[model samples]
Target: MTGWARSPLKSAAAWALPYWTRGEPGRETPSDLFRVLYLGWAVALTLKVLGSSWDVSWHFKWLRDDLAPPHLINTVGTVIVVALTIVHGYTGYGVDRTALRLIQVGTGVFLVAVPLDLINHRVNGLDITSWSPSHMLLYIGTALMIGGVIRGWFVGAPEGRTRTVMLGALFLFCLENTWFPSQHQEYGVFGIHAWDRGEPYAEPILLQFAADQMGRSVDRNMVVAFSLPAPDYLYPVYATAVCMLVLVLARLMIGRAWSATLIAAGYVAYRVLIWPLLMVADFPISAVPFFLLGAAVCVDLAFYIKVPVLRAVVGAALVTAGSYLSLNLQHTLLDSPPLANTSAIAAGGLLLAVWLGGEWFVQRYRLRGQPTGARVSATATP
Candidate 1:
C-alpha cells in the first residue's frame, strides 16, 4: 500500500469510498470482492441518508429550478447504486435464494421510482411534503434496497469482513433512515418555524408557509394552505422503534467488541460529519445526539447480568433511559427547543419497542447459527 493509503484517516476514507480493487483481479476472494462492492453501495446509501433532509430543506429554501445542487447530488447517489447493480448484478451470479432475490427486484423498483418521481413532480408540481403518492415510491425503493441487503446478508455460507462490515453499514444506514424524519421536527434554518403554537403536536411543515425564503414578508394565511399532516410524537417513537430494532439485530449478528457502542458511534459520526455543512450554510444545527453512547455503555453492562430475561430487562431499560437522557442533555447544551413529546408515554413505548426488538433479534438471528434441533425458546442471553 502507498503511504497515503497507510495513514489511519486516509485508510478509513479509502475503505468508505468506491475505489478500484487492485491485485490479481479475479484472484480476490468472493468475501473481499463483496466487501468492496457493498462498501461502495454503502457510500451511495449514505448520500441518500444525507440527502433525505437536505432535499426537503433545499426545496423550502429555494425551489427546484432544474436539477441544480440537491437534485444533482440525488442523481449522483442514484447513479452509484445503478452502477453497483450493473457491475455486480450479472446474470446467474450467486444471489438466487428467495430472500436474496429481492436485491435485483429492489434495484428494479428503485429504477422505476426515479422516473416516476420526476413525472409526479412534473404533473402535480412540487407538493408541500415528500410523502406524496409518487414520492412514496422512493421510500419503497429504498426500503427494498435495505431489505435486499438484510436478506443477502445470510444467503450463502458465512463470509468474513464483507458480511461483518456490511452488517455495520446496515445498522448505520438504518439509523440514518430512522432518524431522518426527525429532521421534519427540527433542522437547519427551515426548522426554526417547524412547529406551531396552538397545534404543536400536529407538527406542521411551517417553512415557506408564511414567509418566503427571503425572510421579509409574512402571510399567516398560507400556513393553513400549505400545511401537511405531521404527527410529531410518532417521529421519536418510530425512529426509536426502528433504531432500537436494527441496533439489536446488529449486535446479534456481529458479536464483536463494543457492538452497541460502535452502532451509536456510527450515528454520531454521521451527525458530526453533517454539522459543518449545516454551519457553513448558516443554519442552526439541530441534529440531536441519538444517545448511542449511553445505550452502548448500558448494553455492555447488561452482558454481566447472569439471568437471560433479567439481563434483557435491565439492558433495555438502561439503554433507553440513557439514550433519552443523553439526547435531552445534548439538546439543552445546544439551547435548541426540546423535542415535542419526551414523556415516558413516548419513552416507555419506545423502551418496549427496543426490548421487543432485542428479543426478536436474539430469536430470529440466533436460529441461523444453531442446529435445527437446538432451537431457542427463552434460552438466550442479552
Candidate 2:
C-alpha cells in the first residue's frame, strides 16, 4: 500500500516538472519559443520599473486614484507576467523553471498585494517611501523575480550573441533596481519644492510635529512640514550598499572588463533617453546623476588593478566615494538651497563593510567557481 501511494506521488511530481522547468512538448535547446517568451517577460519587467516610477510621481503630483495611469501601467505590466505564466503553461515554454521557485512564490505574493494596495490607498493614501508594507512586498516580489531570471540566464544562456545581449539586459535590470531608490529620492527632494510645493500626503502626525516645532498651526494641505533639507547621507549610504552588492555579484559572475561600465552605460542611457521624454511631457525635473559614470569607471578600473578580495574592497570604496563627492558637488553647485552634506567617508565605509560580508558569504557558498567570465569572453556583448 505504501509503495503504491508513493509511486503516484513521484509520478505526479515528475509530470509537473517540465511545466515549471525546461523540457516541454517542443523540447528544443534554448528554444526560440522559450527565448521569445522570456523576451516578452523581460520587456514587461523593464516597463514595470518605468511604470513604478511614474506611479510614485503620480502620487506626489496628484491625488491618489486606483486606476491612475501610473498604477495602470504598473499593474498591467505585472498582469502581463501573470498572463504569460498562464500562457506558458499552455504553450510549453515556461520562464526558467530552472531558477529558484521562490520567484514564483514572490509573484504570487505580489498578486495578492495588488488588491491590498487599493485598500491601502483608500484607507491611508499614497506613500513616498518603500517602507510601507504593500510597497515593501511589491519590491520584494519584483526583486526576487528579476533575480531569478538573472540566475536562470547565468545557468542557461549559451556563449554567443544571445549570451551577450541577455547579459546586458541582466546588467541593466540589476542596475535599474540598484539605483532606482536614489532616483526616486532625487525626484522627491527636488519635486517637493518644484512640481508640488512641499506637498503633504501622508504622515500628518509627523507634519504636525514639524508644525509644533515651528510654533505654528498644522494645516493639512500646507507642506510646511517637509521644507527642511533631507538628510544627505540616506540615499547615498543605502544606494552605495545595494550597489556594492549587485556590482560585486555581477563582477564575480561575469569577471569581465567594463562589466561595471555596462551597468553604468545602461543607467546613463535610461536617464538621457527618458529625461527628454519627461521634458516633452511637461513633467517637473532636474539634472540626472551623470556623475555615476565617473564612479562606475573608478570601480571598473579598480577591478583591473587588484585581485579578488583586494579588488572588491577597493571597488566598493571607490564607487561610494566617487558617487558621494561627484553627485553631491554637482547638486550643491547647481541646485538651489543645495543638498545637505554627504558623508563620503561613512558611505564608503558602509559599502566596504557590506561588500566584505558578502564576499565571505560567496566564498562560503563556493560561488566563485573558476571564472565563468573567462569562458564567456569568446562571446562579445554591447
Candidate 3:
C-alpha cells in the first residue's frame, strides 16, 4: 500500500526533474509556459469589460451616419486587441495541435464572414449597418479565442468543439438583442404627429392631455403612430451584467497572486494609455469622465492585487497624481467645473484607509499568539 502510494509521486518527480534540469519535453516545456499566458488573456477580458463604456456603439453610429472612413486610432486599437487574441489562440492551439486545426479554421471563417457580410449588405443598396451578422461573428470569435485559451491552460488540452459551440450560442444571443426592439414600449404616451407638415392632426388631443396634467410639450421624438422602444434600458444592462458574471467566474479559476497583479497592471496600462487616445481624438470633451472612470477602476484593481510594498507605494502615488491632473485637465479642456473631483479625492482617501487598516489587522491577527512581526515574517519566508 505504501509502495503504491509513493509510486505516482516518484513518477511525477522523475518526469518533472528532467524537464527542469535537462530541458526535455516533459510535463513542463515552452508549451507549458505559453499555456500560462492565458492568465493575461483573462485579465485583458476583465479590463475590457470594466473599462469600455458601450460608447463603441456610438462610434460605429458616427462612422455610418457621417459617411466617414474608419478612425485610424480606433483601427489601431482594434488591431492590437486582435493581435493579442491571435497570439493567445495560437498558444491554446499548441495544447492539442491536430484537433484544434479544424476549430481554428472555423474560427477564421467566422471572423472573415462577418466583414464580408457587411460589405455585401452595403453593395446590395442596404444601409451600411453597424450591428449585423458580421459584427456578431467577430465578437464571438474573439470570445471563443480567449475562453478556449484560458480553459486549455487548466485542462492542458484543447476544447475545440465546446468552445466553438459556446461562442456560437453567445453570438446568437447578442444578435437577438441587437435586432429586437426593447421591451419598454409605451404607446400613446407621446401623442401622434401628422404625416404632412403644418398640420395639427393630433396636436389638440395631445395639448388637451398635457394641459389636464402639467402643461409640457408632448415628446416630439415619437414617430407617426409607433416608435421603436429605447434599446438602452435592456441591451446594455443585460450585456454588462452577463459579462461581469463571467468575469467573476474567470477570476475564481485564475487565483494566483502574481498573475492577478500582472493582469491588473496590464489592464491599467491599456485603459490609461490606449482607450483614451482612441476616443479623445473624436469626442474630446466627453471623453474625460469615461477615461477617469477607467483609470480609477484599473488603479483600484491593481492595488487590490497587492504588489511589493515599495512598488505599491510608488504606483499608488503616481496613480493618485495622474488622476488628479487628468481631472483638472479635463475641466480645463471642456471649459467646465470639475464634476467628479470630490468623489475621486474621497475614493483615493478611502483606498489609503483600507490599506492601512488591512495592515494593522494582519499584524494584530498574527500577534495574538506569536511574537509580533518577527515570528510572522519568519513564517512567511520560504
Question: Order the candidates by TM-score, highest first — what do you get?
Answer: 2, 1, 3
Best by lDDT: 2
Lowest-lDDT window of 10 residues in candidate 2?
Answer: 373-382
User: In candidate 1, residue 224 scores what lDDT?
Assistant: 35
Candidate 2 achieves a global lDDT of: 0.61
Question: Clashes per prediction?
Answer: 0, 0, 1
- Using lDDT, rank the candidates from best to worst: 2, 1, 3
Which has the better TM-score: candidate 1, or candidate 3? 1
- Tell me the TM-score of model 1: 0.67
Instruction: Select the stronger candidate by lDDT from 1 and 3.
Output: 1
Best by TM-score: 2
- Runs in model 1 deviating more than 4 A are 1-36, 86-90, 94-99, 112-137, 153-163, 188-190, 193-229, 281-285, 290-292, 299-313, 335-343, 350-358, 365-382
TM agreement with the true structure for every prediction: 0.67, 0.75, 0.35
For 194-232, candidate 3 gives per-residue lDDT tens digits of: 223443333344334433333344444423212222332
lDDT of candidates 1 onward, in order: 0.56, 0.61, 0.36
- Once superposed on the true structure, which residue ranges of model 2 sit more than 4 Å away at CA? 1-30, 85-98, 192-230, 333-342, 357-382
